[model samples]
Target: MTQEPAEVFAAFRHAESLVARRRPLDALVALAPVLAAEPDAPSVHLLAGRAYLNSAQLLRAEDAFRRVLELDPSDHYARFALGKTLQRQSRLTEAQTQLRMAVAMNPLPEYQEALGEVSARIAVEGGR
Candidate 1:
């Protein structure tokens, strides 16, 4: 099933809206065709990664974020997202690494907060 570019674009937008609305399952459904149609689109993967992360599909979110990184290593948001996903999965060290990189790439408050969180967690766990 080949989707026209316009259809793919519309679907991608719709999926993005769904993700924003906190409807990750619905967003993933809407994104399926777009993902198939635009496998190389880093934005699409980033959106899907966000949807997956919101839905608590940590491993899938990790994979999606990794894909975005592979496509666009300079995407600081993707690194932040991947860090969050790893943090959720209890991979604190890996999460800290990603969040540190994200903060280095772009020092957004949210990224800094995330990095601080993972650092605190690692520190706490290490103290145990």
Candidate 2:
């Protein structure tokens, strides 16, 4: 049986709250049904990316964010998230590329900050 849109969204909201609470496993559980029903939804993918990131599921998070970017390259948040995921995985060069793109697209303070961090890391690693 197909679930109602409202129900799916409600679950999504619940998952979002769980993520905010640092309960990523719970968030993933909350998201599962909606994910199954709407695998291609950008919102679902974004939330899943966030949950996976918080849960330290780095590869899964990267895939989720990459899917979002593939669907909507103009999504600055997705770019930022993907950059952060790469950073967590110690892929500084890839992280910097994404962060620079995100900064050029939107110039959010957070995006700039992340870029600066990655740049600083690169400089340090180069000096070493």
Candidate 3:
């Protein structure tokens, strides 16, 4: 039987609640089935990426964020998350590029802050 979109979204919501409770493992487990069934669900991918990131699973987080980007190329949040994952992995140049793209796509204060932080780090590293 096919699940309704609303049902899928409800499962995503539950996964989000688990993340909010600091149960990222549980969130990931809960999201797994939904992700397999709806691979292109941007929001689910975004949240799964976030949960993985929170759990320090950098590669998995990157994959999830990349999937989100594939599904919604214009999603600034996914771009920002990808940038953050790159930064965490010490891929400074790539992080900077992604962060800049995110900032350009949407000049939100958070994106600007992340860009500024990445810029400062790059400058500091370059001076060393």
Best by lDDT: 2
Candidate 3: residue pairs that collide = none
Q: In candidate 1, what are the lDDT values of residues 22-114, reduced to their tens digit?
A: 999999999999999899999999999999899898999999999999999999999999999988888999999999999999999999999
lDDT of 2 at 28: 96
Local distance difference test scores for all models: 0.93, 0.94, 0.90
> Model 3, range 1-128, lDDT digits (tens) per residue?
67777887788889999999999999999888788779878988899999999999999999999999898999999999999999999888888889999999999999899888888998989512
TM-score of each: 0.96, 0.95, 0.90
Name model 3 segments beyond 4 Å from true: 1-7
Q: What tens-digit string does per-residue lDDT give for candidate 2 at 37-109?
A: 9988988999999999999999999999999998888999999999999998889999999999999999999
The ten-residue window of minimal lDDT in model 3 covers 119-128
Arrange candidates by lDDT, highest first: which order? 2, 1, 3
Let me know the TM-score candidate 2 reaches against the reference structure. Answer: 0.95
Ranking by TM-score: 1, 2, 3
The numbered model that scores best in TM-score is: 1
Backbone clash pairs for candidate 1 read none
